[model samples]
Target: MILLQVQNVERLFGSDVLFERVNLDVQENSRIALVGRNGVGKSTLIKMIVGLQSPDNGQITKNKNMTIGYLAQDNGLNSSNSIYAEMLTVFNDLKKMEIKMHELENEIATFDHLTQSQTKYDTLLSSYDQLTHNFKEANGYGYESEIRAVLHGFRFYEEDFSTIIGTLSGGQKTRLALAKLLLEKNDLLILDEPTNHLDIETLSWLEGYLQSYSGALLIISHDRYFLDKISKEVYELTSSGTDHYQGNYSFYIQEKAKRFQQKMKQYEKQQEEIEKLEDFVARNIVRASTTKRAQSRRKQLEKINRLERPTDGQQEPHFQFTAERQSGNIVLSVANAFIGHDDKPISGPINIDLRKHQMMAIVGSNGIGKSTLLKSILNKIPLISGEYSFGTNVDTGYYDQELKNLHANKTVLNELWDDHPTTPEKDIRSILGSFLFSGDDVKKVVHNLSGGEKARLLLTKLAFNHDNFLIFDEPTNHLDIDSKEVLEEALLNYNGTVLFISHDRYFINKVATSVLEISKNGSQLYLGDYDYYVDKKEEQLLLAQEENKQTGEIVSKQPEKNSYQLTKEQQRQERKLRREVEDIENQLEQLNAKEEEIQNQMTLPEVYSNLQKSTELQESLKKTQDKISDLEDSWEEKSMELEKFD
Candidate 1:
């Protein structure tokens, strides 16, 4: 079943067509990734699908009875309720049913010997039974446990459940909103950059959860690893529209490249044929000997339609880092260092050495001071203790994750030109254009630029400076997936020492020659890329788990028993119990409908006017009501015992 479809969707901003004739479908349990470069309308198109924004032309069709849950990038959740209370609100209807179940119980007991007693008792009994069945079907008894499981998966401790949501940080609030959406259990879930601020352990837990998610997922994310793990299909949105691919991100890249190459070859071949036909027509159309052939060829040329080359107009940025001078073999060294602020150390008791041309990536949990370490090494702030030194002839260039080096008041043109005043005006403009800031875009003020644009501007400056040593802090923070690849290529090709902090595992895998895992316990080095670090970490974990198991300190989840493989006697008992429950439920539904009919008849003048007839109906209703009450007690007992076995 198709849950959602976008048919010929079009969007425009001030006459600039972002994407048009876009078509895609999300089938039952589909996992799709929407990807494009910055400012290419992936987000806008998603907004259209969710109805937050409407398309200029065409329609977004969602199936009847469909429910959708959307989580936008950095959308802060606002609520006065505590964390646990806020999550409970997702099941408000279930809570109401729970209250109704109790109310019906009270009403049923009070109607014992009243006039038209049987009719009233039957009505109450029927309401109670139906309400009880609905309550269990809605999972009212298990909601709290589900909530706890999701909270733990997102790294929320039980103690924090009582904290007011308003007191939480922005990232925490975002996470809470995501948890609420997951519990909503909608038919379709759309998440934009859901991996923001999540650490490796939490990310691992989330990956497992999403892999088994029952609903369809349409995600927009820059985390390549996450996309590779979750997406079964990829939608590559471009200037023309979205192009669908039948596999994960890695597969999409290879297949898309192959497609383009094939298209290019076919286009060239067709062009050669057309050229030959045109040459014959032009040269021989008026000649007596070959006029008939020339005329036929001219007609063929008119009938032919030209093939277009498969290239989106958007230009990929070129980032090249060239060293100005050779640095000493020891580019940087920190001796017995403690790195932090004025009061206390955030990390260290450390020692590190970087060679002339080594690219080292810093990895750590949030607030473990990866950025602070970078600042300390640059001598921008005083180190808490010990000392550090840079080797001779090392001209360091810095890329602040915050982009604090750029003057906010300056325009994009002057942001670069002001740094190199002696450079030609057109040269600076050309560099800005290289980063996709062309024409009027360079006239925008620095403060008005998007995070991605600011990052590009910074890179433009860094490239022009030609420094031999580079230090970056979260350099891939705001870059789209394409820009990240470009930056990775630049860093890999640069012949200089680099020490940067990043949580982009894909980027680290592509560029880092070494990894430094930093924590309060100090820093440890892994002499390879991100995968090697993960493998080594997993090895240590497996050994720890083995030791714990031998010491009787390990506990595992108790999986439910498989019913199909049960012993013959057990299967007989299980079958009998299941049939009993189903029989009771069906009987209760029929009795409720009959009881409602009796009450409606008693209220009419036709039956109420005739007291003898009313008395006869009442007696019949009483017997039915009494039987239902007995069944209710039986159901309760059976349900309790079933829970134990289940």
Candidate 2:
């Protein structure tokens, strides 16, 4: 089914047309990425689709009963309710149904002995059965599990469930909003820059989830790696209008390049033809023998249709970093460093060395204190423990992920000009223009700038700072795809040492010569890029699991009494213990599921209306939960014993 269709859509801003003749259809399972540079009307088009804005021409049709969920760049999920409580709101219907089931159960218990009461009970029971079936179909039993899975995927810990939504930081709030929207299960999900707050792990998980999502998806993101993984189709909105591609980001890149080559060739060919005709006309017009031919040639020239050249083929921001002086061989050293707040240190015992000109990427789950570590190194924040020092002559510049260094009240022109007090105004303006802030754009207040604009402004400052070493936190957070690529190139070509924290896997792969994995266990070095780290981690995990399985099997055999082997009776007992552990784990899972089912049934009208039955079922559910808890404990103990085999 086509969930949405837009035809002949045209949007205008005053006299200027933003886009025209825009057309597309979203099927029930469509996965589309709407992409372009920053100001190409992508957001406006998305707004039009969501009914937040209206098109000046044509129509957009949404299927009847279609539900759409839109996650803007910043979802702004601000609420006083706790995170878990907010999530439960998505299943309010299920909650109400569960209440109905319990009420029916309570009523059915009132009269059960007499023949008339039996008929009444049966009717109530029938209703209860139907309600229960609906509850099950709606996944009342699994909704909490779904909530937990999404929360975990978004990197929210169990402890965060009870935290008030308003207490969360901006990124956390955005993530929470995304989590709620996912659970809403709309017919179509449209996200604008959904990758913003996501770390690499969360990003990978989201990609996997969205790939299997039942609803159609239309996402606007600049994360190439993310786009490559999630989008099956691409819609690029250039200033010229919307262009469609039938593949992922990589395919889009390849196909786009091919088209560019094709257009360039055609344009060159047409230009040559025009030149030849013009030359013939110029020479022949002066000669009386060919005056008629010249007139014919001139007419042909006038009739010729010319193709407008493609606009600079998507201009990338010009980025370059020049180190004023070289640093020592060992650019940075850290010893047993613990970083975080003064009261609560987040990660510890970190030791790492960064050599001169080495682009080292610090990567890990979000909130693992990557930014905190950078701040500690920069002396903006005190290290909770251990020591870190930069080598001799290492002048450092920092790009704060939050752009806290920027003076919000200052104009863009003043921001850069203030940094370099003596520089000529013309030179500063030229520099700003190179970063894409042209003419009156530089007069915009820093605080009013978009995230991408702020990022560009920061880069403009970093460019002229002439620092020998640079530390950046989430540098690619708000940059568009083209800007990211340019920044990647600039870092790759940079002569200075770089230590940066970024969740962008593509950016990490492009810029990093080495990678550091930061976790609660501290820093571990990877000699290569993101892919290498992932491959090595997967190999280690497989090796560990394989070792555990092999150890379990090897020790399971019965044998005569010996130092290395158990007696037959002892072997039997050991085998029994292992089997008991496995049985308990399985029982825990079954019991949990059963507990949830009973709990969901209790909420039906018939069940809850009958006080006796509702009470009995509640008792049963409590018993099941207790059994599950006991089995879980036993499973853990036995699993630990089995682990001793390895």
RMSD of each: 19.2, 18.4
Model 2 CA lDDT for position 250: 75
TM-score of each model, paired residue for residue: 0.80, 0.79
Candidate 1's C-alpha runs over 4 A off are: 13-15, 101-137, 549-646
Question: lDDT of all predictions, in order shown?
Answer: 0.84, 0.84
Tens digits of per-residue lDDT, candidate 2, 417-506, equal 987889999999987888989889999999999999999999999988889899999898878888898898888889899999988888
lDDT score, residue 286, model 2?
Answer: 84
Roughly what TM-score does model 1 have, to 2 decimal places?
0.80
Model 1: lDDT equals 0.84
Query: What lDDT tens digits, residue by residue, belong to model 1 across residues 263-305?
Result: 9999999999999999998899899999999999988988888
